[model samples]
Target: MYEDHARIPPPPDGGYNLNALKPGNIRHYDYWPEPPGPQTFGNTQVIFSDHEKHMVARIRQADAVFGCMAWLTNYAILDALAGLEAVQIVVQKEDFLRPDGPGWRKTKLLRAYKALDKNLMRFNIPWDVGSCDQCGDPSIEGVRCMGVHNSGRKSASPRMHHKFLVFCHLADGYPEPYAVWTGSFNATWNGTRCRENSMYIESEPIASAYAQEYGTVAALSEPLDWQYAWVAPEWRIGS
Candidate 1:
């Protein structure tokens, strides 16, 4: 949708600004600029009838956002998530983190968050570990297998796959969600590469519910605390 991280469409912008007005059929803005406490602004004839003129206000009101994906491999997405305020992040990834990994498996989440602002903190959860012998143990898989385990220590799941984003449009000083984005787009290059679609839901109850789910997953993302050692037990004592 956007040409860059700024979320700006390509120049010579044609067609309507999809998000100029919040989705979910929300025709008016609950929070207004004047002193009448939004009554004057919420007037059906004044706001709804002429909403196209209020595009600036709608864009400024956006703050809260959400994204869920089967596998997040996009750097731009990662940087944006890390910079968002008061965000709880949850994502499943297909690749493993290795210091010596190739291009595909080199997306280090912790590093991504830390690189943003040094103080920026985000709960980056990985796919939940599957029930198997290798749940926590760090034994080598095979000659070609990489040692680094997936986040949440979960084995990769090829079946359960879904991608979505929820954004809470909060006005200055207001700490609540007013908009949300969700869909099957992986929030990565997959969004543009594959046949995917997304919908923007602009309702507090709906947005809040999805946001809560992200919080729940963040809390339950405790991975196994096992370390990986090299293959072939080298049992050399104090020799």
Candidate 2:
């Protein structure tokens, strides 16, 4: 199993070569304005080019399918999820809250909300939110937005702290799962259109670990202590 710490790479440069003593280190490296192509990494080069065609062909021929478990700190996964079939998501309620206005504002979040809305309708899936007390929020749609409250701990923009978890099962037999630490990313056009890195693991052990975390979240999401202010709008309207 890959430990959490192992997944993150060490910083590129050791903290600052304080001693200007190393002669070779004084050589200046030219900065490239554009990113390098696929040849940047050996593994990516092999995967993207025809040089490893035979090995790629073999992987495609394997009867076993592909599965994924991804953890996204930003909205990077939104684009990836667009091509997928089905997904189950766990997220803080604040992640969906975008101030209503004009322009390209909350477009991504709106898209995600719409997609989620459509999937729930198509699958007849039931959705629920734990009471505010258990969720550590003072309110849901009110002053204390669930999405914002859960994600506010480490973020500068409370808007980016939306907390939510999502799971999607593709129709092609392969399954894709995702777990987000913060519920900030919206599923709108602008939300996902950016430069960000989302980690994906095709290993079963990694996927299972993520699934286990999902279960834990679900079990603890029930709101037993807090009183319901009103039925969820979605539930009330039967949308």
Candidate 3:
């Protein structure tokens, strides 16, 4: 991890919006207080805190969820995923990216990983971790990378940098591909601070394609090691 990086970086511009990609009622997460109005990037609508809310709301409605996230440390989104009842879910994430640090502490990332494991265990859900070849962290084992095969090779691209979520059913009980959420947004605090855009596609074909892709990636990935003997519990959520 880049231990010298700023904890809260300056916000960037020109990102995607969820509403602009598909036509549907605007989704919002009520758990957190409402944020400011929508932001726009040229002709496209841009959502910041609202985008996070939209994602939480979508996760609330899903009967099953499958996704790939390049980074994850957002508590609200994690809670939403953990709270799902009777829903089958599998999320693939990159553990070696953007880890929190104050000179090699990495306390935030360790806590996030532990929280995710706790949540998954509570609900009996499944999850996977990507290869560490890109990170070159000898401590972590690279079972199988998601996007690229044989990522262990020095010439190969080692990161599975995809950010997407697919919901198979809504509250109305659709069979599958109820919607697909994809964007540049990461589920970390820093990700929200930056200018980002996301789109929700409600097409069966498109969602189906993503769902299939998720399956293939998941097949190549490895589940979290519950023992986690190599990692220490750094901190607790909301600490």
Candidate 4:
């Protein structure tokens, strides 16, 4: 409904002035000075809102955030997530792929988090390694395939496909989620351009339930004691 990342309309004449607000100037995590409602383009009604800017704005309001997406390659969202005070991101270990010779390799997502931050630590349980015996283990080379029966490692390959974000505010000196964003919208370039639906639910009960689900996923992210080598070599204090 909105413009793609590559096709975002130009900013105002002087460009975005973070210090001062001006008409038609779009600043990160701020209300649009003049929002353009949906426009009728021939037979289609298109929304011109800046989805990335809106998402970043919501993220900036949270003291803590949690997200899980099947596919995530949006750099803007990644930067915003990293800036959060406290955050946990879960994603399919098999999805962050880039070409590696004839095979595929880990994307910058892994290195970006491990070397600089500790928030995006959890790995979704891999359910994509279907029929490894026939097609071979799809896990990137050098990375251990938890599902493969090599020496003594045997892990479950269950589905973990979820696309949602939970935003929490501090309550009683502890973080408590007040809202959740969930839908089929993945945090990827193609995902933003595709036709998808999302929900921004603001309910104490629902948010808390999502928070609990996030906790469960984070706790049981990888197979017991079998960490995804791409995330970190070994667990640390907070991880």
Tell me the tens digit of each residue's lDDT in model 4 across 41-85. Answer: 443333334455556777887876765666656768777777765
Give the higher-lDDT candidate: 1 or 3.
3
Q: Write the per-residue lDDT of candidate 3 for residues 29-68, one digit (tens) a residue.
A: 2132334565545433445456678888888887666667
Q: Estimate, for each residue in 57-149, the C-alpha lDDT of model 2 and write its tens digit.
A: 332332221111122223334333333333344343333343444545366545543442212221122222221122232222101211223
List clashing residue pairs in candidate 3.
15-197, 16-197, 16-198
Q: Cα deviation of 154 in candidate 4 (Å)?
A: 19
The alpha-carbon deviation from the true structure for residue 52 of candidate 1, after best TM-score superposition, in angstroms, is 24
Count of backbone collisions in candidate 4:
0
Candidate 1 lDDT score relative to the true structure: 0.38
lDDT of each: 0.38, 0.30, 0.51, 0.50
lDDT of 2 at 157: 34
Q: Report the C-alpha lDDT of model 1 over 1-239, residue by residue, as the tens digit.
A: 32223233434745333333222322353332321211232212122221222322332345534434455556565555554543434444233433345453354644563343322122121112111123233221100111223446557523224344456644452336555555555545434444344445557777667666544443333222223422212111111
lDDT score of residue 34 within candidate 4: 57
Off by over 4 Å in 4: 1-50, 95-107, 115-158, 171-173, 223-239
Ranking by TM-score: 4, 3, 1, 2
